[model samples]
Target: MDALDGRLIRLLAEEPRIGVLECSRRLQVARGTVQARLDRLQAKGVISGFGPEVDPAAIGYPVTAFATLEISQGQGADVRAHLARVPEVLELHTITGIGDMLVRIVARSNADLQRVIDRVVGFDGIVRSSTAIVLENPVPYRILPLVDQAAAE
Candidate 1:
């Protein structure tokens, strides 16, 4: 959570496949130092995984929607498991506002979205669901700004 750590994170984020040796060369630090920092960062859970980031739209699924689900009483676990089985379900979060759970889903088309929605709400534990299709994403998901702000501090 220092400048070095932030820089290391940004470096990796920009070049996920970059090796530790190259990182050391670019950062002007020893290879061992880069490795140690990376190890420490991983151990601290600051860096979760090195998996590739896939875009839903690029893979034929361009339609994006968010569904807010109201599940049956005490059916959170069951609902969660049911939702987990659905491949289109991208992210799920429990909320305290108007809905019990919020979910991000993707589909090949608007009509396909209905099928996905049906699957999402098929479980008996799910009471109701309200969906909103995404028109555009002016600002997509990003963390670099937060990283830079934290680094400056």
Candidate 2:
């Protein structure tokens, strides 16, 4: 992506509600140019979806936890399907190391977390599971810095 594209992304990241006309005015480009850039970015999969970022904590799920699952051999797909049915299972990753899969989950409380974990490991393929509760988030998830670095390059 070029400097203009970077600027457009940064602008949108800062103010998602802004229109193409407003973006053109702020970036000093034509409305069509802004529109075209946004369209191209979406087509290229650089900008995926414009969905609102929801906070689980704000939605009554204050507790965040990560669970590592050791599944039976050749049961990754089955385990994944099972986890997909659970609403609290926010993110899942096929990880390397001791664990076969790592899942991020949220719950209303510590008691509720146990129930979530129970559901997560209920599948027959899951042989063992370990959980680590997140106590704090000093650095929240972000991509702006990476985006800036890419723009600089």
Candidate 3:
């Protein structure tokens, strides 16, 4: 992508709902140009779907924990599939570390957290799991940094 594509992506990443007309107005380009660029970006998979960012606390899950799991007897895919079916398991990653997988989970209460841990450990392939509850969160979630901006500067 060129500088113009970078600018368009940066603007859209900040405000996905901004219409083509408004983007064109801001960038001083024609509306059709903005629309065409956006369409091309989408077609190329550079710009994916735009959706809401919800707060877990507001939805009744005030607790957050990071879980480290060790799979037993090479239960990889099965463990991943089981975790995928669970609602509280927000994000799971296969990382290069001592643990087999790392999971981010949210729960309503301490008991709820225990239940989550129990359920996770109950999976056939999982041998052991450890959890660390987050006491405070300063920075939550945000979009990726605009790499295009940095390259230009």
Candidate 4:
């Protein structure tokens, strides 16, 4: 990724609805150049998708929590499949730490969170689990700084 790519990405991140022609105009590049760069970025998996960002809170599920799960021996696949079946399980990660897997879950309220947690760890493959509720999200997910650093390189 070059400086132009970084600038283009920053512009896109700010205004996701902007078109290629407008991006080219703002970046002072040809429309085809902008289009080609975007295509290349997508093909290389740098630009994953152009879909609208959806907030779980806006959709009625406001509470957020993380679950650390320790599964029974050789039951990783089964545990993963089981967790994937739950709608509230937003993200899952296999980690090298106190737990075998980490899951990000959401719920409508604190009471609803217990039900979600029960369903999450109910599978026989799961041996033990721990959970922590998110008090606040001072820094949500972002990648712009990395993008700029890559552009600098």
Model 4: per-residue Cα lDDT at residue 113: 99
Query: What TM-score does candidate 4 reach?
Result: 0.97
Candidate lDDT values, in order: 0.95, 0.95, 0.86, 0.97
Candidates 1 and 4, the one with greater TM-score? 1
Which 10 successive residues of model 2 have the least lDDT summed? 142-151
lDDT of 4 by residue, 1-153 (tens): 999999999999999999999999999999999999999999999999989999999999999999999998999999999999999999999999899999999999999999999999999999999999999999999999999999999
- lDDT of candidate 3 over 59-93, digit per residue (tens): 99999999999997668989999999889999999
The 10-residue segment of model 1 with minimum total lDDT is 143-152
Candidate 2 residues 90-133, lDDT tens each? Answer: 99999999999999999999999999999999999999999999
lDDT of 1 by residue, 14-110 (tens): 9999999999999999999999999998998888999999999999999999999999899999999999999999999999889899999999999
The TM-score between candidate 2 and the true structure equals 0.97
Q: What lDDT would candidate 1 get against the real structure?
A: 0.95
lDDT of 3 at 128: 83
RMSD of each: 0.8, 0.8, 2.2, 0.9
